[model samples]
Target: MWELFLTGVDAVMSVQIMILIVLGVAVGIVFGAVPGLTAVMAIALCLPLTYALGPAAGLSLLVALFVGATSGALISAILLKIPGTPSSVATTFDGGPMMEKGEGVKALGAGVVFSFLGTIASIIALMTIAPLLAKVALRFGPHEYFAIAVFSLTLIATLSTGSMVKGLFAGTLGFAFATVGIAPVDAIRRFTFDEPNLNSGFDMLVVLIGIFAISEVIKVAESVRSGKNAAIGSVSMKSIKGFGFSMKEFFGQIPNATRSALIGIGIGILPGIGAGTSNIVSYIVAKKRSKYPEKFGTGVLDGVVASETANNAGIGGAMIPLLTLGIPGDAVTAILLGGFMIHGIQPGPMLFISQGALVYTIFVALIVSAVLMLLLEFYGLRIFIKLLAVPKHILLPIILVLCVVGAFGLSSRVFDVWTILLFGLIGYGFVKGGIPPAPFIIGFILGPMAETNLRRGLMLSDGNFVGFLTNPISGAFLLLAVLSVAWHVVGSLRARKNASTELAQA
Candidate 1:
């Protein structure tokens, strides 16, 4: 253990690697501070570049990017009404209102502090539990994996913030997209359209850019004439320092942070729900548990802390399944798993025992990334907040061009360019219809995992309807999905009844 720690420490101590880690954090903060851009897209853009570096450096870059991007999201959520990522959705509840109330610095400080703590807690949890979890996960065969995947997708669709029908449609579209080019089972070409470039389906990064970055461009263009989408406030050093809630008030919110972190981590370890949905869930949980629940949605720090802490901690929660079982728990980890492949490391129980040193290095890397994110975000606020000052007219076009370049660079194919535009339009349609994009992205990312597993599980059981229930692992996941759906339904009904009562009194 001491030897592994020293080796990992040595790797981090290299000047070049430290520079790279810091660079990744800077880039991630910028990406994350922008609405409609996310950690998945940032990591994807950086992946091609990482292909040239050593395992430690490459992993450091990607992990730093992930940590920075995830943490960076609170910036936009606070300053702008929209969250930079789904994970920041809860942050927006308090953050946007607080910014409106001219308390941007307070919201930002609380968010950053809690986000750091949440991340640290998650890493500690990972250090302790990932190995044991992986050993149990290794017992899962293809059938169980497929079942688990199916359960995850179903839970996502049911839990997503819109009509179940639309969620299902999105999942179907994603599953259909996954089926294109070639069959995963037999290398059978299915929907290649004979264009020769479609044989690999969609590169994850290309899809990410399309669904996120390009979609934002399209939305921005649609609003170009109206000019109603102006940013609400700017982040300044003054804003950062003035974010004072009493230390006592912050201490009082400790339960909110801890509970939200646990919830975020719990939801994260579960497949399909994704960070976006987790934030929404955490926000609701915090509001419900707060002594002054009425303060929720009224520019309170508790809301910001709840959302930021959970979503950030989620990075750790999601890694549990990915590192231990080789099954990606979410989109970012799915991409991180790609990094593991490039290093010729297979994840599972064997990964824990065989690559103990590397595993610890990766764990240590998460801690390093968090520290770097903290330092850069605090000291470098002036540099990043300046981005919001860029006129939308100039910034929009540049981002559009970057989106185009990013999409094309995914596989160096024109088809992906078309794919980006197509998804951009689809995403625009959703926005126009008030369908939240978070669930759609979650559904799309989880589609393949869900589809493949369900098919495999059913085939393994000879089409027995009871198969999911017969397997303990599959049964547990399916059960959770059922309970989640039921709980949401009950909650919604109660909310509607309360609203009706308030209207009657008015």
Candidate 2:
């Protein structure tokens, strides 16, 4: 094993592989910094370029891009208050506020540093316990998946910033939208309304662009129309040195960052759920565990730490299943599986035996890419901040154009563009009505998973509902889901009671 590892390290040290890693990371950062673009798009566009290279070099480039793209999202999330990718949605909750508070540099620094730590931590896990983790993931069945989805759905309560009722409503609305496509098992079309576009449902990317990006553009336009300052905000680099944070502060967040990394790894190992879900889940857990939960969305370093750490850590986590079981952990890995296949390499239990040196090459490449990502972002922090200096009128139009391009680029359909416009209006309405969009996104992503698995679990159990309870893993999650709702209800009741008592005393 030591010999193979050393050989892999040597292979990655070559100039050709090193140059590809740098180029891939640079391109990935650009894609992720753009609001409408994403890592998936970056990988897809550059995948063809890899066909001309060797297996080790090609996979190395893809791995580097994955690392860079996941970390780069924090840039736009902090600077523009728009998530550069779905993985960064939770980032905007605090990152935007931090930018407004003139803590942009600090937020970016925390994001960058923790991203490196998170990736390193996961890579260690990938190197040591990948096979063990993959075996554990194999234990999951439809029942367990359904229970997990239920538990995740209940977490929307934690995201309810202003009103729980509004949050629940938004989540339900998102689920309803998700139901627009064909029903999972029955293969029956319910909400197509005789339109072909609605048959496949709205793309998640399009929805994100519409809700966050387009709604933001609309909000800015409204602010300008109302004679308010149209400029988003400004950040300063003066007198700020070394990540704009203290060692004490970094030490303070060690526990939070560690816990968030674990959450990211656990979630990333699951098929379908990737960094997109883990980042938000990690943020919610961080807020819940914080000494002062109220301080979370108020421009704190903890928020950025939790988000960036989990999402990037997911890079290594996602690879575990892909390498050990030949299963794709998420969309990016699904594409990566294709990259593996194209190179005549199959990833599975025998992969380590069949291609020991190549496997280690990927591991080594991941580490190099992580280091490059840290260095690049460290130096590029100011350049990201400079984006804020661009005039809103000019910047927003460019963003809108990119959003359209990204939407149309999905399936080369104009309907997706229209979908963005429609959802943008809905999102604008959400903003006007004091509803948080995060819960809606969560619901949209998980609702279908829960529903499909529920149906499958029932079928497997011969139409017996008791099967869900019989499975210990599923039962435990379901119980926790119930407890989560009850806990929130109890907390809300107590707060109201206290308010009433104070009023009576007054």
Q: Indicate which candidate wins on lDDT.
A: 2
Q: When superposed on Cα atoms, how far off is each prediction in RMSD?
A: 4.2, 7.3
Candidate 1 lDDT over residue span 1-506, tens digit each = 66776777778778877888999999998888876567877776677667668888888888989989998988888877778777897788778889988788778878888888888988888877897887787688655666665666666566566776676566566666767777755678888878678786766556656666677777777666676554558655653333355788788889988998888888888765657767778899988887889999999988988888888888888888778867666668867876676667777778877887778777878888898887788678778777645665677677667667766655577777888788778777777776655455555555566666666767788878588788787788778767866776787789899999999999
**The 10-residue segment with the lowest total lDDT in model 2:** 224-233
Model 2 clash count equals: 0
In terms of TM-score, the best-performing candidate is: 1
Looking at model 2, the pairs that clash are none
lDDT of each: 0.76, 0.81
* TM, every model: 0.82, 0.65
lDDT comparing candidate 1 with the true structure = 0.76
lDDT of 2 by residue, 1-506 (tens): 68988999999999999999998887788768766566765675566567679999999999988998898888888887888788888888898898888888889888989999999999998998765654565667889878877776665544356677787788788778889889999989878989988888877667766777678778878755454322344567678888889999999999999999998888887654678888999999999999999999999889999999999889988898788766555557755775786688977666876888999999999999999998888787666555434555676677677778767776778998999899889989999999977667666766777789899999999999999998999999899878877887898899999999999999
lDDT of 2: 0.81
